[model samples]
Target chain A: MEEVKVYGAWGSPPSHRVEIALKLKGVKYEFIEEDLKNKSEELLKYNPVHKKIPVLVHNGRPIAESLVILEYIDEIWKQCPLLPTDPYDRAQTRFWAKFIAEKITPAVRDAMLIPGEDAEKKTEELIELLHILEKEIKEKKFVGGNRNKYMDIVSLYVIHWIPILQEYSSKHVLTREKFPGIYDWIDQVLLDCGDIMENLPDKNKMFDVLRVIFGPRNNYKPT
Target chain B: MEEVKVYGAWGSPPSHRVEIALKLKGVKYEFIEEDLKNKSEELLKYNPVHKKIPVLVHNGRPIAESLVILEYIDEIWKQCPLLPTDPYDRAQTRFWAKFIAEKITPAVRDAMLIPGEDAEKKTEELIELLHILEKEIKEKKFVGGNRNKYMDIVSLYVIHWIPILQEYSSKHVLTREKFPGIYDWIDQVLLDCGDIMENLPDKNKMFDVLRVIFGPRNNYKPT
Candidate 1:
């Protein structure tokens, strides 16, 4: 097998998603931490289009976009398939994953990026979106149903990032009662994927990065 | 083989994408046109999450989101592969397809949705993105090289919609000189995928739809 490498940032959910996929696949590779402020030449060369973190370099070729990387990893490493074999099931998983990437991730960014009433408005929108997910996950143990799959991996961003955003904003957007299914799903995913839980960036480090990236807000000061 | 059905709108690029994929695979599907103004119960039932069009139903199971549907069509109907067989090549194809969906589509939407100075600003952004794509396509006969693949299907939006947008705005965002590779690629795609060309909604009808949806502007009065 050719050498595998991952270029990513510790605090980025997309990066973490790639790491989780790699870990689950039990693929040994080099982990290069990127200073997003000063991206490395290698990162620039590999992912010139987005120049974003979480570029998986397999052999000499590189794949960008966390979701795209996840798909690649699944395709390359057959052990513990991230996506379902059934075409319809795979479509559903991809649909939810795309939803998370396109809708949930951006909504969270908006909630954190904007301040004051605007942030609150965005938070409300985020909660509404979570409610939609809650309905979907209510009956299923995991996003792919009865097993962890691509949707579960992508949902990690929502599960992990939402609490950090709440802590930063001092506003509770995702409540246990409101999103019970989501909370249950998170607990199940964490219980199943111990590696992901263990490898997640420390909360304080996440907060520090968030403050640096988005700036501090009420009662949320940089440490 | 199970019954296949496509729920789509004529003027939607995403819808066209699904149509092209099905055609390329030679899959017979019942086409159900949904009125965007008043979406049918079936569309809502099938795609409750997004409540959007371009849903593919197979054996009474529904799959929403155009890109996801494209993948589903490719997977089930293996007669003509939409994605490359090699894992890495598939990853590259997916990366570009995602780039088109996430970055290029939204930029074009912004150009059309925003009015006056804002629209022009977005138009400039769109052109910059197109230039990036042009560089990628310059060396290759098609997006994925030597064949019409997923990237070409997604790029259909840029090829078809850019001219219509230029007509409406009276601003040539895409030109033969500026985007010769893209023009060549478009010609090739149209030449190869005659079904896509034949099934595409008329340009004037598309313009009428755009005017109705986006409203007439800059001396481009609604007919």
Candidate 2:
């Protein structure tokens, strides 16, 4: 059997997290592009519980969820550790990673909704979230202290899709001025992961696809 | 500094999860119950982000979130290993642990809302969730593996609250008939963590506390 295979849509940050980690770890695998609009039976079969993308099939066994996939990838390949070795440090990284995963949905929701219509309150909440993100991260290369780590691969790096969110919402949530640390983390991660931007499907194309599901005025229109 | 201290609330599954883990690992720790209605200032400071209960303060440092605290306790004590030693097994346990945690809120929400309205639909969704649980845990000693493990502690084993949900919702989603292995797990964990139930506050009494927040529920008085 082939070593590793990833079932992913071109647009999802969750998929990219696994992709970048696999590339960084030099894990060889087939890449399957799942058209999320018309999801394949294979993807559905693999991840029946959530039925979502970023399903990593390794050695014929499929692991669903990006975090689950990331952990699985880290376990098999030890070339470059995505997480710190110290138990406390590992916990700290995990705490932040979990925090981001739990909070990101609400953050984006707040960013996209109409101002003053519950959306306004959410937008403020989103800024507060960004502020926390800024406080935790810095100009230092990664969220995990000066290295290209999992936290950075997921958090600081994923905001490359912000332009799409902004185009849809008509409001800029992630200007460099408000969060220089996060901003620098973004630039550094792009440099660190060569041609990472190119890996993401065209932003405008992705946003258009999601608009039917996400709503207008603050809808997602890929860059 | 004392050996270890847990700030918790009576009968809360998250806090109970921590308590069970501590008992299984044979860790002697002082339990400080925080009346969630009137939360302690100390808890606010320790878990500033969430400010919710079940904070494990070892020496001076505090760890928030039940799953995180469970891992912390396992690492600090290291006697009765709650998680598997192998990385694959550990990852699988973590995956289910997270899945359960993510859904507990939604499941509990279903049980709380007025039944027989749109709640019928929500209840079916709830049953579907339990079926997933039932399938994953089919006839096994516990969610993790052969022996009663962390997944049991963190998931259903923490509370007899399932009975409370069944009675209140009148749907009886989780039961021994449908899920015998899990029922067996319930029996084992109850044996393992003796008298923890006595430690839990009366559910009838807790209803009085929750009713104020949830607003009055007509037709069914806490008799």
Candidate 3:
């Protein structure tokens, strides 16, 4: 008997990444919704170093960091392979996934969440990065090549969350005219994979949460 | 026919990581030393995104980022496995490796390289992180049990380069008394594995370079 549980928040991108990966891998997991304001003790105990959500606990052993969790899920399940079989291809997939996590994710946070003098500057930096991504996209239907794979799953935030994020925030950087490649990629992912829509948080509910989070208190930064 | 080329700098820990992994795997390769001050066209061509070193060019195809390159090497050359074969164990290995790369490495760069108002704060953070790592070290002779594996290779900076960095910079956070676990682990790695010392940069040479780099130009931030 295998026990799997995912501790994550609805609106958090990193948390969402884990859920999508598991679902794609066809691994049945218990989703434990965590309140961002008041985190559960298990969450803290599991991930003491960062104390962040999106932890995948397998057989009571907790693995924190969505990227780590995603790789773990892929390795264990092995049904629908997330990474490509080829060594070089796998490296490329890992590379882009990491690029999104490290570079783009932080840019999203800085641009949308924080309100300060550097807002415009941060937004510009994000635009510059997205354009770089646009070039990488370069007519590829999915980040992982054809079907939705690990890189594609990792990039869910860019397409789904970023639009919602743009709605709440002052900056509107990811436009169709500017990032046509990204827009096309998003459409293909959504069109081809109907199952992806299942676990994704309700848009209006996300907006409601974002409205409060990024509402009058534009400076309200979530941990 | 297989041709492997590594573009890396002498003093860089990330660069050294690639060399160590290659040597461990018994893969014969050519080392192309890059003047990080004036990065080559090939380096930029290979890694346009970051344009940083420690890129592994297998045949003609180039793969950048030390961590990504490490995985590539492990997958291709199966003789000496960098990661454990089991899924859960591999996850553990990757988790620790990522922790070292993302968390500890940045803290080190910030604390030593950039002399600023937050130097003290950064040093404290590094110490806190190291202590946390000390707890993890426990009684493990090597990061990879009984061998110098991927995590051990990644953590080379923490033990080898950090002392030299401390000598160059004012902050001496890593000490024997304060971090006995780390110190013991370091001694164990060096004593047991002699090949690790082969590719490691000369201490005196590194000091000379660091002394000039961190000299009067305390604000000299390298790109």
How many Å off is the CA of B90 in candidate 1? 0.7
- The interface RMSD values of the models, given in order, are 0.7, 2.0, 0.9
TM-score, predicted candidate 3 vs. hidden true structure: 0.93
User: Candidate 1: which stretches are off by over 4 Å?
Assistant: A139-144, A220-223, B139-146, B217-223
Q: Write model 2 residue lDDT over A10-65, tens digit each, in one string.
A: 77788888898898788787889998779999998877778888888877767887
CAPRI verdict (incorrect, acceptable, medium, high) for model 2 = acceptable
**A32-108 in candidate 3: lDDT tens per residue?**
99998999999998887788998999999888888888888888888988878888888878888888899998998
In model 2, what are the clashing residue pairs, if there are any? A203-A222, A203-A223, A204-A222, A204-A223, A207-A222
- Worst 10-residue stretch by lDDT in candidate 2 chain B? B139-148
Candidate 1's TM-score reads: 0.93
Tell me the RMSD of model 2 versus the true structure. Answer: 3.8
In candidate 2 the C-alpha lDDT for residue B133 amounts to 67
Question: Which digits, one per residue and each the tens of the lDDT, describe model 1 over residues B147-196?
Answer: 54677788888778777877776677788988998888788878877666
Cα lDDT tens digits, model 1, A153-205, are: 78778778778777787777787987888888788777877766788777788
User: What CAPRI-style quality would you assign to candidate 3?
Assistant: medium
Alpha carbon lDDT at B195, candidate 2: 54
